[model samples]
Target chain A: MELFTYENIIGIAAGICTSIAMLPQLIKVIKTKETADLSVTMIGVLIVGVSLWVYYGFLQNEVPIILSNSFSVVVNLTLLICWFLFRKKS
Target chain B: MELFTYENIIGIAAGICTSIAMLPQLIKVIKTKETADLSVTMIGVLIVGVSLWVYYGFLQNEVPIILSNSFSVVVNLTLLICWFLFRKKS
Candidate 1:
């Protein structure tokens, strides 16, 4: 079985994009100390959704899915933490 | 080929979760007319990333990937439009 193929590369690209999609928001929340406008439900749902992706990756033995979703989980978790800490103050 | 398998079901679940993750944010933006804390960069990147996923899906001929990404593209696009419409007013 080929580990790195054209199809997986495309998946990796998609993963990279979606994985880092929330970086700016997380940074903005941390730097500006503003989070009221951000939706808690959305972030929460993302955590659940990305976790499922991680599970799906595990089931499929897809490295990109696992790695990307793991990275996104971390990002989303950071955002959630920031939201909790700063939302009240903002 | 099994169209509905346990693995595919997991993927579909993941897809559904992620696909709808942005709904809350979009709704909040529309309802409150607030966009200050929401990062435009994040949304823009999501659009690009999800589009790649759509392409990846096409390459792989994965229905879940195609459908879920297509849904997310619509959702993210709507969010972007909402950001533009309400960001200024808020």
Candidate 2:
């Protein structure tokens, strides 16, 4: 059996935590169909941040990191879009 | 001048992106003082994921990773707490 190296454990934990963090927002957005309370500035800032992460992942050649964060970018962008559309309608 | 190696760049980018991703929700919770739209399950999942990342960092002995994710844990936990408080009040 392969030993679970400390590095692998940490990486996995980071991935899990970050990924789960998105859940509450995702659920809230989906169920409430309301993002009035959400801030546009915050979402914009987040987009910039995730974009940097993607760039960082590319530079590092870390496939797992890149892939996970890329997916995150997509999810965040979608939420932002949803917020915008909802706001415009209301 | 320190050379921006591919790994370093990627690490920086990931850090920026993941850190920024928290902005929208944080702002939303703070501004509106409402977490009605947020999901408890999602927050729970994220907490687990970040915890894993912290563990992974410890296992790997990567100070940067551990430090960054530890900060993330604090931010995320704060948001979760805010949500609970808001929900209870509402």
Candidate 3:
């Protein structure tokens, strides 16, 4: 069996991309105090989704999926809280 | 092995949740015509992330992942275009 096929590479890259995808939004939200345009439903659903992914990783015994999605859950949670705090501004 | 293990159930739920997570945001954006609070960097990164997911699915030959992320890519792309369109308002 080959180690690190193209599928593995792309899957890993995709996971990493999603894991860190929210940082920019969190930073922008904190810096700009803007949250009105961000959808609460989207954030809520994402939290649920990432949280499920984390559990699924455990069930699938996939460490990479677990770690990446755990990070995403944290970021998503933080973003959600920030949205609540900042949405009232402007 | 059972067909519907907890992992599969959770994984499928996660995929479904992530797939449709953006609809509410799109609806909100269209109804309110607000996009200033949205992050272009976040959107850009997400578009890339989901697109890569689609490719990863193809590489893995996972029909569910491909279908779900394809829907997400469409929604994310639409949201990006909407962000561009409505950002100037208010």
In TM-score terms, candidate 2 sits at 0.68
Clashes of 3: 0
At residue A49, give the lDDT of candidate 3. Answer: 90
Question: TM-scores across all candidates?
Answer: 0.81, 0.68, 0.73
lDDT of 3 by residue, B1-90 (tens): 353666667777898987677677778878888887577887888888888978876765555456777888888888888888877785
Q: Runs in model 3 with CA error above 4 Å? A: A1-3, A29-44, A80-90, B1-7, B87-90
Model 3 CAPRI rating: medium
| Model 2 regions more than 4 Å off | A1-17, A27-32, B1-17, B20-38, B79-90
Candidate 2: fraction of native contacts reproduced: 0.86
iRMS values for every prediction: 1.7, 3.3, 2.3
Q: How large a fraction of the reference contact set does each model reproduce?
A: 0.91, 0.86, 0.84
Model 2's CAPRI class?
medium
Model 1 alpha-carbon miss at residue A56, Å: 0.6
**B31-76 in candidate 1: lDDT tens per residue?**
8888876678888888998999888778866676778889999988
Taking the tens digit of each residue's C-alpha lDDT, what string does model 3 give over A18-43? 66776776777788888875778888
Give lDDT tens digits, candidate 2, residues A12-80. Answer: 456656665666676777787888767777777777767676666555444445566777788788888
Each prediction's number of clashing residue pairs:
0, 26, 0
User: Residue pairs in steric clash, candidate 1?
Assistant: none
List candidate 1 segments past 4 Å from native: A87-90, B32-41, B83-90
